[model samples]
Target: MIPAHEKSETHSKIDPDLNSKGVDEEGETTDHNLTYYQQMQEASLEQLAEHRALLQIFNLHQAGRIEEKWKENESLVVWLGMQIAILKRDFTEYSNCPAHEYNGENRETDEFDEEKELNELHKKVLELTKLRLLELGMFDDFPSKFELVETSRPSKNTINKRFNKLLRKIPSELFPSIRELKFKNYIQSILDGIKKITIGHKIYYNQVTADLEEKGKLKFDYLFQTIEFLLRDHFISENDLKTLFQEDHILRIFSIYFFHSSQQGFSSMVKQLTPSFITDQCFWKFGFSFSQVLDEKDKVRMNFELLIAHLFFNGNRLRGFQEWDSFEKSFGRKKYLDHLKNPDRLKLSTSLQVEGKEEVPPLSLIGTDQEFSGDVNNLVKLFLATLNGPKKTRALSGLVCELLDFINSNISPGILDRSFKKLGSSKNLRLQFDLILIPTRINYSMAVAMEFHDIAERNGLSLAPKVMESIFISYQDRVISLNKELIKVYSQFKNRYGSLSSWLKQNPEYSKINEKSLNQWLKAMSIIIEECATEAKELDRRIQAAHGTAH
Candidate 1:
């Protein structure tokens, strides 16, 4: 244990990184003090999208990276030192020999082997460090030999100098008792510092963040659809698409599907497919082609509609409420409509902020997905206003990003409690359900709006009460099946956890690795989080299944 005088210094270093810009002197964590992963968890949805986009650029999701510049990094040097110390401690304890037992060498004897092991501990330390890092789902991404920088590699002397400098930064009041500091407590501080450095290393770029905020409004489902519309329009013919793309079919899926929403893979896939052929191409399709946008066929003067379409995902993601009416009537949803007054009073909105894209692909790619910055109050207000203004009650759900985010939150909550109950007490009851609840509600909301201009029949009209009940029955059955699968998952996770604990038992210092990294790796390997469709999607399946070919 450290003397009372040194306790403060030890606590100060062990608890917080004094040099880290965002932390307060008192070691209180601030927003700036958070690790990158923690910041990601708390970031706004728009911010999250940009961050994920940046990750795609860096290929960070594959594994963590280490840069050449980190060789001289104080935190990394200290971590290497700390790791070497740990190796020595474990080796000494397990060797069952005193430090004095080193009479230099015999070739084959166990005593000789012990001496050799002690001599080789440094190499073992590096191997142990890499193994530990790999277990945390990371690998060294340091530059190859030809890319080496001129800086000297970290050595014991450098580590000592850096560590001493760190020690000197402690308040003078705590300096007197430095000799009393405990080894374990000191190493723990190094661990904290190292973990923070790694977390920062995995994700750090000020400019990308700035770019995300600046261009966020342009990156939405409309972007993917816009890309698709253009992609389909790009090729000379179907044969052209097939010849250029290995997975050409992935592009034909006009909605958010596969990696279409992830700018990571999507950008890389289309990086070569630039549209230099026509700034006027929007005139060819969707009324925004370059030809249509030009003031005259040959003149370069731009049209407002062309610019608006370019900036906002081709003008369909957001539109006026009145347009919904015109679209339904002129574009043919006349059969489902009733007359309503002041349809033009409000503008419709959806397609979350270009920045606000969710990581999970929406089940349906449409304008109805919620806006990132919207509130429940606004959605509720819209619901109330429609009751009075539009007696016909069509073209609603426009202003609010309705149902996509939170329909499940209050939508007939607890109505399913009795339905969710199993009939038999037996755990093995097999159940089958057609559609999850959220998707069905999303479908219902879209049906009311008729954004796609389909008549009530094929749209979502078939999802009346009885049909909804059938879908619910399918969902309940799926829930039971999911529970059974979860039980098996639990058993597998238990075994994995036991194996991890047993491995760590062989080296107690492994406990000091970052808890977040451990948990992330554990959860990823175990698949603890469930994956299912968004509300828009489940509704479609439910609808299609219900009306596959009625008599």
Candidate 2:
């Protein structure tokens, strides 16, 4: 048996041609024969046509129409020039054809071949005309239409032969200057103007922006005219056109134009040219241009506000709305009531601690005192600044937590309860909070606990008694010591009374209190109050906790 590599080589060397006839298996000989046959056929046809035309030219020379020969020759030259121009135009159009063809195949055939052949014939006619003109000594003097033709004209074929020869030596003068002049005067001139206008517009916008910024006041008329010119003449789309008007310094130019145009009853034109919706679309769709108008900071804020508003407006239609409801439901009714009652829990403090500035006053004082309102506004601004301008999840969550805390601390329980019911009816605040918070599973527990505390504290109540009872029952192991002490106290207090049942009948509020229930309620209240402390205490604890070592 052969080795594997040697066997593969042996198979590879076994040529198919070895089993075939004398023909090379590569097919080179057949391909060469086919190509040679085609070339020979083309050459034969060209030779035949040349010979026939020569004989015809000889015959035409025997006839007499010599005087009209020059006109014929000139006509042939004109026809050839026209054909060339048409070919050039067709070539250009084909070259720039759009990418609509499947698989990138060429679709057009050489349908202009007949016209090209006629062009060749005309070239020959021109050569005959030119030589005849030279022989008549009219080449030196400007030949009139009649002088170039022979009185005894050659046969048509002879004339055709002479024209073909003339075409081979097509002189710059053989082609009439008028045709060239017309092309340069008409087509070229228009193309040049288009090029100039494009170049000019680019330069003009750059210079105009620079000049306007330098002058500090842009001329409204010039700006408007420039914009219109760009749109109409340059094929500039609405987006690019708007960009020219977007530069802060340049756009100011339009402010005056806008006002003047509106005053002159050109409001419709202005609307058509620069609609607000279009402007907003341009800003949003093309962020760079939008940034140019509002600056990056304001643009971000604007977008964030718009996003929030859009989400709020479409909350019911959003899939996430159900999840938002689920989150609110998780916090329970009592928690939401607490949020409404306590404004302290809801009012987020500014993360920026401005030194030497008095603490922000109460909202009630905002209406009564101008300075107080100003301070509050400033504080609100500062808090808003802490929102990280826009679309900042961390900042938003912090703000939501602060607001809930503020409401929990400040708002009355009755008002908070009403607000909770309203929240349930409207459900808009849930959406608003969700837009800002973007709840995560990791932060879910914290958010729920914070909300629960804020709502309960604001409502001037504890967590639902049943909830406390449930927690105590579920986590009895964790609270067993506290429960035992509470049981001892309850037993002693009950012994001082008739019995556990009698004590409960005496005071319904405490009647059902077990050792575990008492402990859990106290623990739940402590958790709620601890989480609802003032900013100062919260900050201090956070700082110490950060430094504190775990035992």
Candidate 3:
């Protein structure tokens, strides 16, 4: 009887057909094939019922719910073993069939060494059952049916024994080696027959060896086949191959292979290969290359491509390498030209004049793509211009450094400051300082102050009465103006003093003004500023005292 599962599988594969009998002239009554069909139907139903019962028993055993008495049920074991053998046979038959064409007939028949075939099939079933039992941790009890098969057909056992001996002789690992040797010989035979496959065309074999050596041994044939498939599929072009090989660097080759393989699999090869790699030195080279390339469109394309490549590779636009690459690719060459063509790009002005130094006005800043031709003359003109401008209008020490950076120069802060100071007076420049210039100048001032403080402290001059007084006063004034609470606190102090000048006589606790207490002072002063009145006058007094000036 057909099992329920097998019946379902068969039903899914078959379609019902209509059967007809002789019809009367009026088409009202006719003899039908109902009796024959009913018999077939009854047989099918009985088969299905038997199959269902077998399935129930199999499921019970599978789920470990079968009773101990039923564990050794020979009938159930035999049925299951037969089902497994049939499944394997059917699977092999279907696998071997040509998918594009079919002939209507069972491929296997009983006449062809049926016992040997059945024995072999039974062995496969036993192997699978053993594997299952192993997985279930029930390896001790192999079914007796497997052992009884040989005795049941003693003559057949001799052939089965020989086959089993041959199977035992074959090592699983050697199968692949044999397959490879056969494939190689087949290809060699083809070449020998064709007489066209020369050693020169065997470049791929060498490449495969080298790749294996470098990347660790892998399936060369598989990789080669994949590359061939990629080429055939138009996922990668000849240009890409040429470019990747032309580089010849091992790392670059590795990168290209990785990129190409991944992209081929996903069709993103073009995106992967479009970008050029970047490094610190690459920026300078790229800049130089951009300058060498004359056409604007070519320059833009090259620069933009480099920029995009840098961005893609680094995964950031503002990183150190990325920014450098972008800047050099974008404006390095163009700026060089502007330095030559436009005087404004190099302009400078200062108010203070020194002996033998000519006064100059500030040069106009050049825009991104403007042309300039003055070159050295523009630089000289800018220096002179910056010297002649108001002291505040002169470039700050940091600005000078940045300008040097733009020109790829290396002028020290002291030299730059001295150069500017020689040309312009500090007071005149101070009046012209804008917020843009203020931060730069303030930073420079703070830097200079820190340097001076460091040098003085190192030499024991920082603690001098005058220096200490000046620093204290300056810090106090800053604390008051910078923080409203400090101003308010100073106001309260002034109210207690009954006059601003009297409050100035009170010395601040300088020992408490160390770095550790600076933040505390700031907080305390914030409260004072917020709560105090007449704060500005008190602040002025403190500044005068600190500066060694009397109000």
Candidate 4:
């Protein structure tokens, strides 16, 4: 006899017939498919959510607990795994099948990952078993004090493993070599490749190398100039450059190189760049990605600060060398003339004004397709998307610095004082503007749950629990997709920016604010991260209850 869990009706609910429509031969059955579709969609979403929750519980369970459960499900689990393997085999070949030419019996199966479906089914089975156990009050059987004492006792191997785990959890900044293994490998390969190029072009390589290597030390200017010449001359292909320097690894490498080769401080190193280099219009010479060079230190706060200083004050967009290949190739094109014009009010004042120094040359804006504007609102969008993809917090942070730079450069002290008085309430500040205008779903959901619901209710608009659940779950997925690096960076930004703004307000001087702002931002970012994390926990509970998964 089939188990109640494996009933035909259960299977029908799990697998909707895609070809079915609202109409049926019998008038009474006309809405059957429609009802089925709605119910199936709802069940599908609940099951999907339960899959995630079960995965989390599995991850968090102790090894002993996992082993115990595995024993309970061993044979059925193995059979399910084999079935999944067969489904995967069929699915993989379905893509290449010639049967796709017809919609008849030879038609290819609809696109899907068979393994994924089977895994979901497996998880559902386990969830049902878990529910049954819960119903039986199995958890109410508490262990004796003696048993607890014995189970809690740690062995020598267990203690060592725990210590190692703690060490592994330590932030990567303290162990760069361990954390940046991929980066280190790539850098070494590039250096080796460059060193080998000297074999064929011995004279040219020696000349450049000798010029750059002054008294057993590599000069930064010489290094920059040589790299620029090599790139401009088509000595290095765009693909090779991208492979070597993509994702701002160049910034980290430069940081390491600077520590080794230069006695000058980070600020001094930046001071060497020309005024035009920092402005938005221009990309760098040979391309260097300086987005998150200091990401490991001070929890990305310092990275943001350095990026801002480098771009606005020291004058390096640090966009990376790949961009230079395109810009250099299109050098003479009368394109992007709009941006080539004097930057909008958004551009930070050049170091010429900051240092009270003479103009080095005519600051020719780099011609580009993208226009640079002073609008922090649009910039905040890029900042949020950066959480999901390639552009790091550096872009947002640099823009923040630019906004700060402009405010300090343009706004008077008395006006700034007035702005500070209205600071917490006013959304004019760039950071606050970002918090208000970023348009994140979670931010909106939080507002609705806390305040908007009441306003909506008064206006005769009501929010359904399902709508709120959807929003929170969507946000949870986004947070999960951020992986680790971005989560830390974003948390840091939300935390640090508040204090950074406050400190900047009190001090009101860019020169005085300096890197000391790093710690203040770090502390603030940590607090924000903790608060948001707590909120996420609460949201998870609500989501579970909505899905009928709460204990």
Estimate, for each residue in 1-551, the C-alpha lDDT of model 4 and write its tens digit. 11111122222222211223322122112244456545544433433333223333333344346445433433222222222332233333332333222223322232133223333433332333332222112122212111112233333344334323433543333324323443234233434433332221111112212111221122232233233222322223333333343223343334323322322211332323211112121111102222111122221222322333333321123345343223323332122222222234224333323332221211322111022222222333333333223443333333443333333333211122233233343323443333322322222222222332232233322122343334334433433332333334335455556754564355232212123443343344344345555755665565566457423
All candidates: TM-score: 0.15, 0.16, 0.15, 0.18
lDDT of 2 by residue, 1-551 (tens): 11112211221222112111212223222333334333333433432333223223333542234324433343222322322332233333433333223244453342233223333433433333334333332222222221112332233344334434443443334435323443223222333333332222210111212111211112222223223222222213334434443333333333322322222211232221211111223112211111233333233223323222222222223334333234323332233233333434334432222343323434542322332222223323333342333332223333333333233223321122223333352233322222232221112222223333333334332222343333333333323443444345445544443543452454332232344644555577465444434433544554465456332
- State each model's CA lDDT, in order: 0.27, 0.31, 0.29, 0.30
lDDT of 1 at 511: 32
Compare candidates 1 and 4 on lDDT and give the better one: 4
Tens digits of lDDT, candidate 1, 1-551: 11111211222222212222323333333332245313322332332222223223234434234222222232322223332343344344434433221234332354354345333433322333432222222223321111012232233344344434434533334323232443223333333332222222111112322112211111222222222222222211222222222221222121111112222211232321211112222112121121122122112111211221122231133356443333322321111111111112111212321333322323331222232112223333333343234433312322112231222112222112112232331111111111122222322222222221122223222212333343333333443444444345335434445644463355332233234643443343233112122333554555565466432
Residue 405, candidate 1: Cα error in Å is 41
Residue 130, model 4: Cα distance from true site in angstroms: 74
Greater TM-score among 2 and 3 belongs to 2
Off by over 4 Å in 4: 1-219, 254-423, 428-551
Clashing pairs in 4: 278-315, 287-320, 287-321, 288-320, 288-321, 289-320, 495-524, 495-525, 496-521, 496-525
Candidate 1 stretches with Cα past 4 Å from truth are 1-72, 96-115, 121-551
Predicted structure 4: lDDT? 0.30
**What TM-score does prediction 2 earn?**
0.16
